[model samples]
Target chain A: MISFYPGPSQVYEKVPKWVKVAFDEGILGINHRSGRFEKMLAQVYQLLQEKLGVPADYTISFVSSATECWEIIAQSFVQESSFHLYNGAFGEKWCRTTKPLVAETAGYKFDFQEGLDLDQVIIPEDVEVICLTHNETSNGTQIRPSLVTALRENYPDTLIAVDATSSMAGVALNFDQADLWFASVQKCFGLPAGMGILICSPAAAARAEELQRRDHYNSWLKLRDNAIKLQTHLTPNVLDIYLLQQSMLERKPIDKVEEKVFTRYQQWSEFIPQLSGVDWLVKQEALRSRTVLALEGDPATLSALHQKAEVAGFTLGKGYGSWKKSTLRIANFPAMKRDAIDGLQTALLT
Target chain B: MISFYPGPSQVYEKVPKWVKVAFDEGILGINHRSGRFEKMLAQVYQLLQEKLGVPADYTISFVSSATECWEIIAQSFVQESSFHLYNGAFGEKWCRTTKPLVAETAGYKFDFQEGLDLDQVIIPEDVEVICLTHNETSNGTQIRPSLVTALRENYPDTLIAVDATSSMAGVALNFDQADLWFASVQKCFGLPAGMGILICSPAAAARAEELQRRDHYNSWLKLRDNAIKLQTHLTPNVLDIYLLQQSMLERKPIDKVEEKVFTRYQQWSEFIPQLSGVDWLVKQEALRSRTVLALEGDPATLSALHQKAEVAGFTLGKGYGSWKKSTLRIANFPAMKRDAIDGLQTALLT
Candidate 1:
């Protein structure tokens, strides 16, 4: 079966071979603190740097999921308040998750078709954190990178935390534009659902040092300390980390990957509209996410299409949040085979 | 090579085949919110209940690791402070991890040679949570079940939390003896690292409801809410959860498994003491953990033996924390083959 579901979408076709390599090399049997595990982590970090063009001064750490990063940000950096700019369900969830943790968490919900409007987002002077969902997986929308760059310039003293959950590996993100950027590997990295990557600028580490909340094991101070030693603060998903390194080894830089993603996304973006009873959800062309694409139909029409896709051995992503029954989502990830994408388009056409 | 390392230890021999099954069945591609995932999770919980004899009223949930349970306990239940009774590094680590998050945290360290003495452990009435390490992997000691039962009787009102990281699947634990019991799967359940099991009594759930700390993603209230729906609060380690279900299908009940563990442990208990320059770390026979066996020797002797074992194709567990140089830890987890243990014994004897 070919899966077009976003996040936990599909494993790279080569993953089985890499997993065998991990088994043969006893990767699953090593202690977390062993030198072999440490070297593997170092290599993974180096690969992320080489393949993604992450800044030399930035730090990369593995977490359980991108959702954990929300908790960490609220616990470690935001002493008083945070301001969230969002348009989709995921953005709202992040804001809701943060509200109870701090004195004040204010949210500005932009129009879904309009994307993030930096000019209209007003933040209080005391809000230490400004949260942005770099790509909103739920609604198939994204905050343009230039807008994030502008926001960083506008709020130089405030920490910029980007939920790049669906965009990290498939996009060429400017790490310097945000202090903390997090993503789950199940999305564009083309691995399974388990591990998350947290990229921190030097500024984000300093902020964590300033907060010094070491109560939780996943606290930034503890995570950063262990990550500097090329180890996780806890026993991590070693097999997934190994799979990530192997998967990344087969790829070129993010620019190249992003180019391929655009080509595939273009295939969907151009073809999805022509299908009977289906229309692109995000009316504005510039607002749609390259990785997670959504299409609209009536509830019955969408449900019928979903069933048809399943019977055809193509697993299409179910719509989320408010659009659950009225939309169908498709993931355009780097690991998705060209033939599989072609098959999906072919099935839909017939 | 045969691995005897405690955690991230050897997976069940059938794991590769099961992973192939998972890949073939498209387990890696399903959306986390899909019915398929919910059903998969429900089946896992059912398997755990049947195999472990966990009480009908108890709730079983999965977290990233056993360490994450420490944060959940501190953030959700503890209003004032917690008292920890521990003999090894892991117990003290739990205490230290809890300290910064609550009002006041206290610890009572027992002798490594004598396990937990529940008779002497006194908790202040105001203390909300009581932390215990059922098995101390660092020095290979365990608190007897009877002692935990007595402790529960002594502190009837306070919540009891057990860190059974290395013992849960290997021991026949009484679920009624504690409110919260947690363990990572790598040690006893014999799976690869990345997932943890948290078993909660009705009282533990009540305490979580009363505290209602929803600030973090891992807060007990949120986890319990999602758990009731046969789902996790976040995108979980689906592949690991599936692998765990497949692995547990071949196992018998906990009592039967524990009997085998005792038999295997007896083999090590009798043999390790007879080896040159090695003695049982836990002097009391009753105090030794059935799963993690530690041997004592001089630093040079232990180091030399460690190197020799490497050449002999035996991966022995390393000493940890304060005993880093003078002891060797051997995980006698359930998945270890009898022949592998015999091979280690033969190499040591020669």
Candidate 2:
């Protein structure tokens, strides 16, 4: 069945071939300290930078998942307090998770249907980091790049960290807008749900270095040091890294993927509003996400639609958190072709 | 090539078949919160308990790697000070890593050639946890179960945490001797790396609950709570977990595997002493490890021997850390057949 369950939704067509190659070449069992692994990691980093528009100065750390990144960011950079911009479930969860670790976590909650108002955001004097979720996968609302640019302009001293979990590769992100950007590979890289990629700008690295709290294994400094040597602080999932490398090899250019994705989202966003029995979660066009299309409907009708989609060989994403029964979250990740989205739309109408 | 690189050496023979099954079932893209995933995780946990003798009261948390366990232990259990029993590189590294996180970390280093002297070991009044490595993979020496039993008897109030990274499934560990036990899947479970299993006994759970420092996503308490529902705190490497579960299915029981490993190690320990060039690192037979055979010799000769073995379609583990040139580490994990070890012996003699 066709799957569109947001992150970990679908894998690239090349994964099977790469898995075979990894098995044949004994990639899984190779020593992490060996020259082979070092070379593999170096190439993987290079591919990531090239394909994702990561800055040449930015360092990438391969971690377990996006949630781990939240802890790393909190421990390494947020020495005192972090100001979070929250609108949806994911944003709220991030703030709640970071509150206990940091000295203080303050958030300005926006309506789920509305975008962040930069004028209303307050950064206390002791705030060390400004946290924002670029794409809230839970409600299909996304933060515009202008908001990040505004925050960077206003809070030049504080580090800006962006959770780009659901939109990093599916769309073009202004890398310079935030000091740290992170995404899990399952969303747009079309890999499985085991690895996370964290991009740290020089500014973010400086903030971590200034704090020098290298208490955890995946501390930003330790991760950066290991990345410099083309390795991780611990034995990572070498097979997943290999799989990601394969997915990035000779694929459609990131820009092309983004264009296709946005075009499909644009069409669907217009068409979905005209459809009966469902309504878009985010009211504002600019606040809508290009990666995940969250549609709110009657709980019974939504459940029936999900079941009917499955019967038609398509699987739609169930709503997350509190909206589990009333909303349908459809992933428009790079791996989802235009025809597939069209099929989902037809299935929904039927 | 026949791999013998200690951990992440050779996976179980049926890994590819199981991976194919996962792919066929679309396991990679399935939601972690789905009923299907819950069933898979429950079965995996059951297989681990049956195969490794994990206590019925103990809970398991699937994490990224063994190193993550160190951070979890330090944060969740070690409120102030921890006494580490250090011997080789790994043990020392654990102590060093934990030093930065806990309020105070102290260690007594033993010579690589010797095991821990329980009678001489000191415990300070404020020491909350005692850390031990079950198998020092670097030097091919293992801590006998008697030591853990003695420690448990003497320090009933102190938490005992075991880093069973290299010898968990290859040996029959007394799970009751330690409050927490963790192992990486690549070693004896015969799966690729990237996933770690953390087994927390009732006492360990009590410590975590008493402290209630569930800030981080992978905090011990958070992990335990999630484990109750057969889930991890974060999106784990689904493919690796599936591979591990497959490896556990219909495999040799832990006792049978342990007997085979010990018998093989006994034969090798006897045969290697008669070899012309190489000598065993751990002098005492009782202290020698059953999983990894660390053989020391002239650097040039060892390198040449490793090359010869590779040419003969067998790959041997190069010396690790400081003994990079003078040691040949051979993995005798469950995946390695008796004939393969015999073949390695013949090649080394040649």
Candidate 3:
């Protein structure tokens, strides 16, 4: 069966084979703190850093999922105020998780058709943290890296946290520009949706250490302490990590991976307008995401197409929140083969 | 290589085979909303309830991990006050997570030998929630089911939440008696770490619905709503769930499973005292957990034994927190073979 739903996306064919070896070899039950488990985790993290081109100083902490990372960030930072740039549902959800803290949030809602306008959005000087979703999955809108570049120049003191959940492994991100970056393994990493990889800048770690409030599970300082020993704050998803380690090893360099994914997305962008009663949801070319393509069509026609696609063994993502009826999201992560995309194009045209 | 580290404990031998099937069959990437996923999850929950004897009204929500369940409980139930019963490290960690909204915490430090004192611990009328760890993995202590029964009788209005992280499937737990019970899939489920199964009473759902401010991601209301559709609030650990589903189907009835595990523990308990300079960490036999047998030994001897055991292809759990220097934990879960335990005993004696 072909699955086109954004994530849990497809995994490498070799992953299950490795999982079999992992099981048959009796590595499944080992203590995560043992030397054996530590070596496994270290290898996984090293491979992750190597694949993502994360700087040597940046440390990777694997947690349950990207949603937990939101809590980790809010619990660790946001002691005073956090500025959030919201464009869609996922961004709104991120902003909502920060409710427990005594922090003020600033929201700028950009049109789904346009990229983040750094010039139009204002950040107060006192805002201690600024959070943005690098790619808005709900609407298939991409935030240009230039936005982060601009933030570093204008708001030097503000800690930048990017939720690259749907973009990280599919694109090249500059880790030095952001204080904290995190994503789930399922999306572009082409693994199951169990583990979240979080990279923290030393400055972010220091900020977490200075926080006065007691944080037990989501505490970045506690996580940092554990990371020093190559452990996690709690029992990790070992199998998912194992699969992710294998997936990263199978990935090409960022430039090559990004080029292929971006080109496939460009193909979809150029092909969609040729169809009757179909158009892109995020209308502007520059704003559309390379990994997730949102399409707007007549509601009845989209519904018919969705049912037809499912019957033909392609499962697509529904438009989230307000756009639920009129739109469909197509994922073009590196895991999707060109043949599969070609099949989808043929099916749609038919 | 024999891995004996107590949890992320050893997976069932059949686990990898089923996992490979899940991957090879292309069932791994299906949208959790699809009929296929819903059927798989429904079967999983049904089997779990049957095996665990959950009440008909209680609903099980699958999450990324047990720690995320803690965050859910914190966000959902602890609006006015929470009372945490701490016996060991995991228990202490739970208490630490509750510091933000805790009205007051009743810290009853029990000797590693004794279990929770049901008579001495008082649940205040004002306490909105009562949190406890069912099995203290750190000190190898297990709180008797009688404690929960007493709480339910005396404090009918207060919601009861238990973290059965290391116990659940390893022993008999009365799911019908508790308002909310959650455990990780790793320890007793005979699977790799990633997912958590949370069984919540309708009363707990009502309490969550009453909460004025709930973080969106960890909010029980959102989770419960999503669970109705057999989906999670976030992208779940799909592979873990598949493995867990396989485990649930393969699990023997609780009576037989518990009996087998208990008999193994009995053998260890009877033999542990025979070792020179070694003693049970929990003072009383009644308080010692059947799943995790905590032992206190001379540091030098323990170190020597640990090395010998490692060479003999057996790995043991080190005592966490204060007991780290002098304690060793032995897991007697169903997945642990008798020969492995015998081998460990031989290694220790040598």
Candidate 4:
């Protein structure tokens, strides 16, 4: 089936070929601490930095998943507390998950469709880090790079950590806008769900070192010590790293992929209004995500639509959290082919 | 090259074929929380239970690595502190890693040439957990099942956690002896390095509930909550889970595999002693690991042997920690082919 599910949405056509290459080259059995592994890791890191346009000073860590980054930030980046600005469920979950780990966490919510109002939101002086979701996968709302860059200007001292799970590879994000950024490879990388890419500016590293919370295995400072040496704190998912290297080697640069993503997004934006059933969940066009679109309908209607899509060989993402039955999400990732997109649209019409 | 490095060791021959099946089935693109994924996970969990002979009340959690399980146990299992019994680097590393996270910790190290003396070991009353390594990969030592079962009888109130990374699938472990047991898939399961299996008993679950330490993403309580629903707390390494499922399906039962492992261990024991140069690192045969063999040699001799093995198309594991230059390790895992084992012996003879 052609999957339209957001995150783990679609496999890149070249990935199967690459996996075979991995097998033929016997890359799966090498020791993680060997010189060979170090070289492989270095190449993958450099490729990501070049293709994703990350600054030279920003270093990256290979983690288990994007969710683990929340733990790392809460454990090591915060001295007292964190302030969370959220518009939807995924963003809210990150804040709630950090509360018990850190001394305190305060969250301020905004309307998902209305977008963020940084002008009115107040940050607690004790807050050491500000957490925000760059793309809210659960609600199909996005805070653009430009907006976060502006937020950086407003809060010059507070470290900004962005969850870019659904948007990283499909969008061209300015690395200077945030101190720490993370995403799972299952989404835009179009590989599988096992590894995460954590890119951090030197400021974030310095803050982690300052807090000195190296108690946990996932402490950001501990992670950095090994990462700077081109190694991981623990035995990593070597296959995924190998796959990521091959993926990045073949992927068009971020800007080109972002252009295609926006064009595809525009097609969906114009066509969804003409469809017989379902309406956009995010009313403000500016707030809607470039990588994911959530469509709202009654439960019965959405269920029927799901059935039709399944019968026609396309699997749509069921809604998450509170939107479980009322909405369906579509991924507009970089590796999603034009044919699959058009075919999904054709099936929707039927 | 046939890898004899203890882990991320030789992969199963069938894994590449199974990966092809995964690609054709489009398993990589399926959403992790979907019904299809849940069923897949349930089947994998059941296969492991049946094949590994884990107790009925013991539940399994799929994590990123065995190292991550150290954090989970420290975070949720111990009420005050843990007492560690170690003979080598891997176990000592675990203890040192936990010191910062735990309130207090004490370690008793035994001679690697000898075995653990349970009679001489004394654990404080406040030590709520007793940590041990089932197979110490670093120095090729082991703590057998009967010993741990006896340890359980001595401290019935305390939790026993075992790191069985290199031996879990190759040996028939008595799950009743420990409250928690963990292993990485790249070793005995013969899969790529990306996932870990954590099996926890009902008592461990109850203790986690009593502690109520749901502070982080990798918390045992949080992981169990989702695990009971046949879901992972985060987007997991889906590909590895798929591979594990296939690996378990084709695997012999734990008892049968254990028999093979012991026979292979015997073969190596016979062959290594007849070789020209190296000597056994552990003089006591009873303390030696069934899945890994360590040989003692001078630094220059070991380095030359490594080069010789490379030229002969075999890879020997370099020693770790204190034994870095003076020793080498050989894996006697289940997936290693007999021909490769014999071939390595021939190369050594030359």
Top lDDT hit: 4
Q: Model 1, range B69-160, lDDT digits (tens) per residue?
A: 99888988778889988888999999998888887899999888766666677777888889999999899998888888888888898889
Cα lDDT tens digits for candidate 4, B42-158:
999889889999987898999999999888899888767988999888899899988988888889998877787789888887788899999999989888788998999999998
Task: For candidate 3, write residues A201-313 as lDDT tens digits.
Answer: 88887777678544546678778888889888777887777777677777788889999888887788778877788788877788888998888888988887777776676
CA lDDT, candidate 1, residue B225: 87
Evaluated with DockQ, which candidate comes out highest?
4
Candidate 2: which stretches are off by over 4 Å? A270-275, A337-343, B337-343
Model 2, span A193-293: residue lDDT tens: 88898999998888888899887888889999888888788888888889877877766667887888888888887788666788887777888888998
Q: Which stretches of candidate 3 lie over 4 Å from their true place?
A: A99-102, A270-274, B270-277, B338-350
iRMSD computed for candidate 3 = 2.0
Q: Which of 1 and 4 is ahead in DockQ? A: 4
| C-alpha positional error of residue A144 in candidate 3 after TM-score superposition, expressed in Å | 2.2
Better of 1 and 2 by lDDT: 1
In candidate 1, residue B228 scores what lDDT? 91
Deviating ranges (above 4 Å) for candidate 1 = none
What lDDT does the true structure give each of the candidates?
0.87, 0.84, 0.80, 0.88
Could you give candidate 1's per-residue lDDT for residues A10-57 as a string of tens digits? 888777677766776778777889898899989989999999988889
What TM-score applies to chain A of candidate 1? 0.98
DockQ of each: 0.77, 0.69, 0.63, 0.79
Of the two candidates 1 and 4, the one with more favorable lDDT, higher being better, is 4
Candidate with better DockQ, 1 vs 2: 1
TM-score of 2: 0.96
Instruction: Going through the candidates in order, state the TM-score of chain A alone for each one.
Output: 0.98, 0.96, 0.96, 0.98
